[model samples]
Target: MGGIVPMRDAGRTGTLPATSDELSRLLTVVRRGRVLTVTGRFREPRSRLVREIARRLSSNFCDGAAVVAIGRPFGVRELTAALGCVPGMPFLPYGTADAVSWLAERDMLLVLDGAEHLAPEALAWLRRLLTAAPGLRILASGRSPLAFEGERVHRL
Candidate 1:
């Protein structure tokens, strides 16, 4: 489920191993409409590895998947923009349950990144999303489990 894909370093002139075969396998699972959750430390300042992984997944799922990256320092705008997010401010209102519910109905893959930093709120949101959106599949990357029933975990 994993292969060494070429990734670029920001300040260097070489490639590195950025993602695991496990990530590839997980992407496949997402393609097949299964929820894929990942737990680990995420360092930003986009590396070639991250870009490559995103590229592969985007190519495969395209309109059928969407990624939700939640973290402190909230660089979500940057990442989502990079992923070609359509221009709209859905997360502008804090704790808006209605907005969250609306987002959950889209037939897209969800990527919940950096949930470790916002465990309580993020987990609650995930739980609600899971319950509200039957067609939604989640791919979460955090340091711990959201602990919702039926979640499949992959550790890195």
Candidate 2:
């Protein structure tokens, strides 16, 4: 949609090419839900497709969109670092509280691409983020769902 967004690669997996119908469905779900997972094996085109969706729909969000490429061994630290990269966020020290506070006031689309594997603590962190940031919407691409209270999964 724009310039190449830098991506962090997880271990390689097959590509699942995206179709316009799939894109439309995903977009619809994102608009209605707080969190969505495009579930597929690692290294598929899920991240690319999610980024495209973010680009297309970011304008609907007040603070716009940020796509974070989640790499292997995903954890709270990585999550915090990724969130810090969102435009205008202060330089955040590695901590969950900082992230939660910062995002609490913003409206944005946060796309976590390549989140196929998340440890329990990381999941907890995401839960806290969702609970605190009322205006934040997450579109994640992974092999499995985050299983939050209102998560919507689109299996690829």
Candidate 3:
């Protein structure tokens, strides 16, 4: 069920209106940092903001920007699938190391949405993903920050 969603610029329609000041701040964060975590309370529009920022900054990444829904317990299979990698033989499950190796050389922006309940295993894998993929930038939207070593957090 997991698939990569292309980053779409919300443009002038179908988007929550954001203050120019807030937009500017987020844009700066996306451009200047490798990891950004957008934090807000329940029912907030953090995902919208994350998507908008990803759209605006897509050009900076050579492999383009993609969104991966992280609302449930996610792991390497889900990540690999979202990145358009098919799950191989059922007896040989895709592992985190494989996902990391697959993504290691790509310069891309990954938007992770609804990560409030992300499992510890998934979070650990994310840490490894960031470590292995030097050209990768992650923009996450959740109720709490992912707390990666170099993560930049913006609270709404």
User: lDDT winner among the candidates?
Assistant: 2
The whole-model C-alpha lDDT of candidate 2 against the native structure comes to 0.74
Overall local distance difference test of candidate 3 = 0.73
- List model 3 lDDT by residue over 29-100, tens digit each: 877788898888843478677878887887887877877766566665666666663122122225666667
Give the lDDT of residue 146 in candidate 1. 58
True-vs-predicted CA distance for residue 8, candidate 3, Å:
3.7
Predicted model with the maximum TM-score: 3
The global C-alpha lDDT for each of the candidates, from Candidate 1 onward, is 0.49, 0.74, 0.73
Which residue ranges in model 2 land beyond 4 Å of their true spot? 1-16
lDDT, candidate 3, residue 102? 72
The TM-score measured for candidate 1 stands at 0.58
Name the regions of candidate 1 deviating beyond 4 angstroms.
Answer: 1-23, 41-54, 59-65, 73-95
Candidate 1 lDDT for residue 150: 73
Better of 2 and 3 by lDDT: 2
TM-score of each: 0.58, 0.81, 0.82
> Higher lDDT: candidate 1 or 2?
2
Q: How good is model 3 by TM-score? A: 0.82
Q: Order candidates by TM-score, high to low.
A: 3, 2, 1
